[model samples]
Target: MPREYRMMTEAPPPLEITDLTTTFVSRNRRTEVVRGVSFTVRRGETMMLLGESGSGKSVTARSIMRLYGPSAEIGGSVKLLGRELLDLAEPQLRAIRGAQIALVPQDPTGALDPLRRIGSQLTEVLAAHGVERVRGAARRRAEELLALVGIPDPKRVADSYPHELSGGMRQRAVIAIAVSCDPQVLIADEPTTALDVTVQAQILELIAELQQRLGMAVLMVTHDVGVAAEFGGRVGVMYAGKLVEEGPARQVLSSPRHPYTAGLLDSLPTPGIARGALRSIVGSPPSVGAFPLGCAFAARCPHARRSCGEADPPLVAVGADRVAACPVVNTEAAVA
Candidate 1:
């Protein structure tokens, strides 16, 4: 296993989230999108929040960054290198947003300003964060950043507008902006959603390489199991706003302790599995604020019991460095 794949035992992780929750308050109703999700990302390690759409993985990532507006109520703790972020004032957060912490948003085209040149955008971030002050110096550093992210012709790409670059190049430019100040933590939410397979692989590889070199912790939110496997660090399986299971990527994916995790793996297309023979989970995930009283996944779980529907299951120890919120699986494991 690569060093990045192993859990770092550092005293203070680069990022630590505890019992995080996000609730959207509208005129008539409140929707809790993220419910008590928690995890830690050690330096130089990638912690993947893997789940299907509407599973709240992306919401959880945003909660860590405190990205929601006043209508969204965020709770619990988000600590970057032991500093609490939830209570930080807007100015304080503004100082940290792109310097100590950065985000590679899902849509790179939307992330970059269309009217501005890519080089100008990069220089803007550099100047805003005080990384470079002089106009010429900032422009040169922006070009260096473009080159750092593997753009072959940094000068040309920097000079081009957002619409002028290819999708892959745009995504690379977004990453360059994100890492311009050498943040301690990088949050990549669905970084490969709209990219081609080849570009997706390249982006993932570039992020991994950058993580290894910069010693930065990565929080990667994606619905693709392949991305989780490729990153190969820690994996947290989320469903209906809660973490259903979490463990080392290889262990959880290979020997899933939660039925939802198993269902996701089974749905993948492998060489041994025939064409059009995927085994999908029975029901769709529940919408926010409409979750059942008990286990959110009980309705679709194969091993659900009468008690499973009575209350929300708490995450329990399933093995070394692993936890799952499923009593049936825990009971079976204990018996075995």
Candidate 2:
């Protein structure tokens, strides 16, 4: 049967974050990394959080899973399945992490245990999450999971250790483990970052196939606009811990309202451009916790004016299903 034709019932979305903030503290000094980042991922829908490094995209994902350790301070609400997760007890959060919300990390080599075989690792996850009671049941379930993620030979792949498998295979194994317990939400944080271009495309296709099969909301984070465009979903452009622009992926790519977003799109490599003539965003990204009080992108934004430095622009509706945080662009749109 065709993947698109796969039947999936409507499942309630699990994630609804609001004013979520994550701060790291050391020696009494605090660095606010993710400041009031808000977004939603509905069932069977993908939400790509697009940004450059240090733009608080990864931190926001970690905060959603409560991965920040004892040193960090988290504020605001992270409601999963209509329940507030910000203040949940450790055990409660533990129950939710793998069983309800699964994460496919960037580096599969780092994510997988070198000392353990892939089969054992996945079996352990299944047993730990209470998906399977007996060892035999867990092992069988692990093999089924490996095959579910499109591994050619599930048994052989499962028997091998992380080092024995190729990079793409390792990623597939990681994903298989993530979905073993059938999570409602899958948080894929740059899952294809380390793979070659061909493998990246394959892995992304596998993810899409699995998302449709399982009917789980996917929150994918990436630095590439091309990836976001290809992924084909709603996109949230993050800069300096805030969503600068957000809308349908095609709309955002075709007509970017925010200068920062336009800069990112302009920076994509195009075949029409001459060799060595690739456009690049000017200036460096602001350091964490040191961003200016107003618009964080003002220093680097070409269209920035005096008022851009004076006050931060709120994310306002620019069109149907679109919003951007840019007074300059907004005013230009209003006039034109």
lDDT: worst 10-residue window of model 2:
4-13
Q: Kindly report which residue pairs in candidate 1 clash with one another.
A: none
For residues 130-221, could you state the per-residue lDDT of candidate 1 as single tens digits? 99989999999999999999999999999999999999999999999999999999999999989999999999999999998899999999
Alpha-carbon runs more than 4 Å astray in model 2: 1-12
Query: lDDT, candidate 2, residue 9?
Result: 43
Which candidate should be chosen as best, given lDDT against the real structure? 1
| Tens digits of lDDT, candidate 2, 78-129 | 8887778888899899988999999999999999999999999998888887
TM-score of each: 0.96, 0.95
For candidate 2, give the lDDT of residue 320: 99
In terms of TM-score, the best-performing candidate is 1
Q: How close is candidate 2 to the true structure, as a TM-score?
A: 0.95
